[model samples]
Target: MVKPANKPQRLSLSSLKADFSSAVSRRRLVYLLCTFFVIYALCYQWQFLVSLGLGPDNIHHMTVGLIPAVGAVVLSLALYWRHLCIASVVPTALIAVSWIVTGPYLSYITLIQQNTVYLNNMYDIYVGLYLFAILFCLNMAARQFLNRKISAAIMTAVQFAAFFIIALQWVYFALYHSCITTSGALLIFQTGPAETLEYFHSLGVGRIVFIALFVALLIGGLLFANYTQKTLPRTPVYRKILPLLSLLIIFPSVGALGEEIFPQAFPIRTFIDTHDYMERSALYAENHDGKFAALQAVQLNPSESPNTVVVVIGESETRTLMHAFNPNHVENTPWLTSMKEDSDFTLFSNAYSCVWYTVPVLERALTEANFYNNKEFNSSISILDMAKKAGYKTYWFSNQGSIGVADTPITLVAKTADVSEWVDQELKQSTMDGALLQFLQRVDPNEKNFVVLHLMGSHIEYRNRYPKEFQVFNDGTVNQQADFDNTVLYTDWVLSQIFEYAKENLNLDAMIYFSDHGSDPDKGRQPDDISFKVLRIPMFCYLSEGYQARNPEVVEAVKQNKDKFFTNDLAYEFVCGILNMQSPNYDPTYSIASLQWKMERKDLVTRFGKVSLLEDTEF
Candidate 1:
């Protein structure tokens, strides 16, 4: 093809306006906006409903959720109302503003604002999208395969079903705080096979009648709307362009099929994925329940003097980063270094986190669970269960979030405790760790209590982990290192507060502080890096004056184990030894303070999938 070589045309505002007006009439714009808005709502329905049940931020959630439905109804009316020379702006304004405000860019913004991580990031709010895709796809498919009469029938059925579901969901949410899930289904079934209907009836026959009546009204309203939408007389030119819109909608779901890849840009797929997760989660919950119930009871012997044990679990911290433990003189750990020389505090020289992740490591550390006998450990009962049975109050205070309670395995452990309080609502980095202290100060401290404080220490996105006022080494180092040191410094301050309270105010026994896992400080080290620093964690015991005066043997154990090679897999047994609380599961060899305790080749588990073969690591 030969170029005509015409001079390039300069764009102008008037020409642009004319092109836009010719391409998209007000009626077509309304239809397009309404179409896409419906799709967006479908993707976010689950997230929106969840936020509604959350403590705060429901107003924003409500706005995002309702706009699409209002747009849909208005657009449906506009279809027939236009024939009667009624105002189209009623629908157009609502649909147009909603579409642009909650468009793709807005979806990304909403996702970030929601502070969703992992699976949730894949599912949370995106500007109105999922519903539109389904509608547009249905219309285009109908246009190709069926006549206008059949197409109308198909659309009405879909719209009615969708409307009915939405109505039903509202009532269901009112009755129960949550949506249908596998755990809920199992719990319902566990009540009794025949009690499902009786349970519904128990809500009162009046409530049932009201729900039925409401559903009937919604169905009638949907039918009326569908009739008007179908009977609209004029054929619009935008109908030709709708096929093109349908292709664009379909493109996200199947566009990568040509390259043999399936991406997650489609909204409807998130809903499907959520449904699948619900089913799987429900099955697992049911199976786990049976095993848990069948397990032998947790047994513990209460000592002559009831002990008040406190466990502080830190995050993403390594001994190599702490000034108290590391060769380098890092001022980030000033408190720990100052406290190290105190006879009441015992700093363990050789300690390693058992696993790389928070939940996995804590599961075994707090309970008896391990990779080897997971079924038995998960079912056997936790230290919290035993603590309660032994007549001690157990409390779980966390700086982390309580979202995804079912999927978060640590939540199951938390439930075994007498009291569980999560200070952080969102999973964002800005939530301070000091909030855990508020819960601690308010709780009854005089009683025989076992409290666990989970902190967000030195986790990723290091810059967001600390405030500017607390920053120390920012001007002349890699920013990641400065941010990391800032977190550790903040952690040092936070830990000192807990210690002061325990020693000065509470009837404290001993407090043990350790990390869940260690991370490479420079940032972004590969998971496969077999470095000693990544697994090595700083652990110390702060024994109150009363505790030391009562149990002299625990002090001796701490002294003897100061140099022992400690892996956190033995943490539960060690806790048992520290508190002198004996259980049948407790092994003398697993306790570092015990003479029989010894490190073997099989004891060391590394991130690179190695065991029992560390070359140069020593405590």
Candidate 2:
């Protein structure tokens, strides 16, 4: 087709790409990018600062966000005035050292409190430096593409908006992580417009005013960041060093990549995963819905006076590290060790945790589920169901978390009981397990009951597990073994208290105590790992005089099978054998207490796979 000469030529839209190069220089871009990270880190982590300042003792205080953010700001300011670098290397050195101590390296104190090896302190500094370098490089690289004044203003505005939202989210979570959790989210999730407005109304005018001011401060900070940039001279060495910094970034980029691939380790991703667990928990709830009621309909006969069963579930405990089990010369668990000598106590020397993770392990352990076949895990009748059907008042009092994690499979099973009570509704490690004892004292002793006490036993960041008084083992050293021992001691105390409470107040007959899984004290950074320590848990049964008279044979058999290999996944059946409850799901073959029990020969099972504790192979 012939085109008219008067007609304009068509412009290709594909060729159009906005350029901000004239406004933003490589150095200025680097400065701005660096500022963005520093500011965001500050806003997100300011809540943690209150903790770092409080020292190692008050470790529950969140400080990671605040320390690094402040450090970055100092560094950014130092680099801003080119003269600050030219003035003297000494001041720069001082400033750099300050950051290493208080910023990313603040993990130093945190690791010390965890009782980790001294090597972890060096590793902490290296990680902190690497992180600082990564952010430093990023700020520089973004500025490499420059733009005009208007373009720069537009870019700054965009960055400000993005950071503002992020700042708000961090601020909200600062308050949230301190207390708010899945239940609160679910409450907000289920609330309608009227309810939402009522929630705001409940915050009241004074609180509302404070919230408004808090928001305003965040906006003001953004403006201040822009001002800081304007004060700096554009003349810079950023472009020349960009390649070196970028090359340095490659090492830390692996962290970014890992965060992308395994986001659960990252904060935002962790929040999402925690929330996702709730969603999965909801599905778990749905799958098991009405199944408990169905189990009750089965018309199972209860043994005469089943008495009381207190299934005390422990967390992150290693039997090998325990004095009652191995001692390792750390008498951290003196009371438990003493209790083990009592004739009433029957210890399961070879008890293995069903899995490493909390939710997965609890689901399998409590339900009629096996490691290989998990179908019935979500659908089958639980021990709580068996308890309820047998005409006993079932109560679940968990130190872990009660309300927010209702959808979690473990919580779901807890809810299956007649009454589920959580001592720590916030679900943060901030609360000590001793609070569980208070809830125990409240349970009605007159009723025929079954209670499950989910303890936060020696989970990591060991210092937080106990109060100041429990710091009996090497209180002044960065000895993780000591800290771990103290936690075990603390756990020993907690278990003792529960046992005493059961004996004193409630209709105490038989008590079964076991851990969900063990933890590698040396490696966990908020407690995550799997090894022999992660699987081996101290499980034991304590029978009162009346129970021994009624079921002497079962008690005797339990003692005999202490050396036999067994996974805690079969704990429900074991309890059934002790209680003498009959149900389709109750297999005497799996219970160590039952004479018909068949030992899980050779391999000890776990949530991931099986490992023989006897063999010197990798767990």
Candidate 3:
């Protein structure tokens, strides 16, 4: 026995090989998981990390922390690269790419620039990551059962669809400098074929070609990567673990937390919100007739004489960009600027739209339901109803869309007028606001008239909003700000035309002008990224000598409150007060033209009272 022991136990080659293989397997497992963790963190938390690292307050952290953290991540990724399974890694990478390429990351950056505290918090990051993890697990499970060819086909199709969506979002961001939202989707649903064509055409050939090429290359590369991927030998443990992980991730999203978490995901969440909006719009339409019928008539107190009043509702006109409001800006509103010298003309220094969208803003601006009143929108009576009750013939002339697939709440309010006319009968053309002047020509001078002129002022595709002659800011170059300035100029011209016609022909006693909502020239009026400029609308009242004489106290009140904070949702009450009409809905406190009118800066709000104007530093 001793002689046999003395020979020394020789290590078996197969045993040594088995030990080395086990260690390699363990390292590969650790690396594969690290890869998943890295992708997950980048997909959901990059925006937060970026904001944290690059924020003005984080300069010290950037020097000491961020750079080292980035280096560590790079090293980890390199180590993980060799162990990555193509079946898992490729789809995850594609999903991560979608998150980056789509509008969210860009929008996040833009928001952070404007406001340092705009980054998503840890809670939001976790929710997004959880949802993404569930999606990844499902993708893994799909690959586990399907053959390599079928898996590749499915993966390619998914990536292609994702690429197509990303391209659409990219194109939208390029044109609007913002993300496509539920409101944007509503605009799409409301748009007619001709308008849709114009929208795409506005993207120009260069952008169109770039988007097409970019998408084609992305899809082609993704397809190649997916198809050329080599199938790795999957263990029974892996097969079991993948299904279990998928079930675990899916359980939370399908259970109580699903409703809250799932809607936080992009593209899918956008689609969900759009669908919800459609359903709400349909319900509103269905209930609108009854609501209209149920509206109570307000008591009419006539003026000393039959007055011809015109309310000019401008679209996407921010006072911050108007020369009359911001003297530092370009002189695009020379007519309004000169009108300021007139004794009868009064320009409100602080005026905001209750909401930043056309439909919601107009719904409240034209109705008795204001942000402060808490009145139901459907139940409230419109300005048309109030005017008609006072025995004035009401007319609505709009250069904007009148009818889409469904009647918007604003359109419903517009239709309540004695006559409703849209420049584009089918919303099929890009008609200038000048076309609305033709409708004003039909006004009967003898009758008491209340006319609404809704102009497409400074809306998107700003170049199309004006004629070639009105392109004063153009230097034979593509400048969005210049195009916007040209639109403001054109709008000023349009306003002057409307005012002169009403004054010279229709015995215009009083004329009021206020935009439905304002817009950001750089970033169109996005609800989520609302700035004070987006709510800071241009508001002015032009009182003829006759109106000034008859309503001197009201005129005095208007002059006094011109510098006070006013939101357009109170336009109804202001109109009532100015016209010397007595109504149950009339609240002198809300009316800027009433001696009792009062509003504090703290009380001011926008986005239908959801956001405080105090949040905006510009306000």
Clashes per model (N, Cα, C within 3 A) = 11, 22, 0
What are the RMSDs of all candidates, in order? 10.3, 13.2, 11.3
Better of 1 and 2 by lDDT: 2
Best model number under lDDT: 3
Off by over 4 Å in 3: 1-306, 403-407, 426-430, 475-479, 610-619
Candidate 2 is scored at a TM of: 0.69
lDDT of each: 0.59, 0.60, 0.69
TM-scores for all candidates? 0.61, 0.69, 0.56
True lDDT of residue 23, candidate 2: 39
Could you give candidate 1's per-residue lDDT for residues 71-138 as a string of tens digits?
Answer: 44334333333343212222223223333232233333333454322122221232223343344355
- For lDDT, candidate 1 versus 3, the one ahead is 3
C-alpha lDDT of residue 204 in model 3 = 86
Alpha carbon lDDT of residue 587, candidate 1?
Answer: 62
Per-residue lDDT over 1-619 for candidate 3, one digit per residue giving the tens place of the 0 to 100 score: 4564566678999989999999987987777567655754464355544332222222332233333223322333333344356655555445545655444565454444322112222223334334334444545555567777787778777656645655677677777565554446668767999997897798889877987888778767766666665553477755675466457545654452365533554444556555665665576657756755655454434455666999998988889999999999999999999999998899998888888777777778888888898898777777887787677899998876554322256677886788887765522233778878888878898889999988878876565578789979965434267888998999999999999999988989889999988777666434577777788999999988877777778888999889988889889888887777675656778888898877787988888688776777864
For candidate 2, write residues 1-619 as lDDT tens digits.
9886887766655433223443345666677568656654543343243232222322322234334434443444445334333222232222223333332233233223332111112222223333344433333343444433433344346444434423443444445532223354455456799987887798789878987887677545433442333222344455555345465444544464354322321122324545666676687678766675455333233336535679998887888878777855577778778887898888777778766767667777787786645546667778887777767889888766443332267777787677777654522223578877777765777778888888777765576678789888875544266777788888888888888878887868889988888876555543343566677888888988888787767877888898888888888788788777766667787788887887665655564555555652532
- Clash pairs detected, candidate 3: none
Candidate 2 least-lDDT 10 residues: 115-124
Best by TM-score: 2
Question: What global local distance difference test value does model 2 have?
Answer: 0.60
